[model samples]
Target: MATAPPPKSQHVGAAVAEKATSHVAQYSPDEKWAERSRKAMQDAITNPPADAYAGRSVKNTGNLAIAFRSLNEILVRNKVRQTVRMTERHEKKGTKRRRLQSERWRKQFSNEVRKKVQLVIKIRNRGA
Candidate 1:
């Protein structure tokens, strides 16, 4: 039986979203979604939509900073994906489940440590 793929949810991470909280996204997604995401992210960084800077002047330093900041976010997202893929290799079916569970634990623990130091405050209230 064929399985339908999960719906894609776009997440735009801020500077400290990684430290503040773990992203509740799927791991080892379908090949098509992964390929599409990689392409979209690259296109986003290189060919941002016109309205992204509608009223802002590129000549202004702050406006430029915003652009750079967004660029950094894309880089960070790619970095996280790379970090996962860096260690990834073929595993026996039994071990694959354990490996993913460990990844979840690591992500959970990371947030706990950051929370201890009160870095959770860095997360912005978006679209408010």
Candidate 2:
């Protein structure tokens, strides 16, 4: 006797999985970045700084800069080399020209941020 075909539910489930995987594969670089940013924001909001810094709450304020600063401070206290990158812009006093001076502003990141990013990836991969 011939075996019976798979149930309709199995086919539907396979199709849903294919669609979901295809959607993920089609995410653009910007979309991926936005997704990561959102996750980081959520993590920051969930885990607030322990000490009160100038009575400012990184979570409540919804400021990524402040959250980064807090994370950097924690890394510093723990003697971690990974730090957040920061950049500043300044206008020179002269003719009708504006130029950024290297000495005036710099973009820098420590090894701690990398570690943190890796941790985030691990957490995401584990479906947590």
* Cα-based TM-score, every candidate: 0.30, 0.23
- Local distance difference test scores for all models: 0.67, 0.66
Candidate 1 clashing pairs? none
RMSD of 1: 24.8
**Top lDDT prediction, candidate number:** 1
As a TM-score, model 1 comes out at 0.30
Cα error of candidate 2 at position 124, Å? 59
Q: Best-fitting candidate, measured by TM-score?
A: 1
Clash totals, every prediction: 0, 4
Which regions in candidate 1 have their CA more than 4 angstroms from the true location?
Answer: 1-75, 78-89, 119-128
Per-residue CA lDDT of model 1 for 49-124, tens digit only, reads 7873343333435687787676666657657556668568766877878878999999999999988656444544
TM-score of candidate 2 relative to the true fold: 0.23
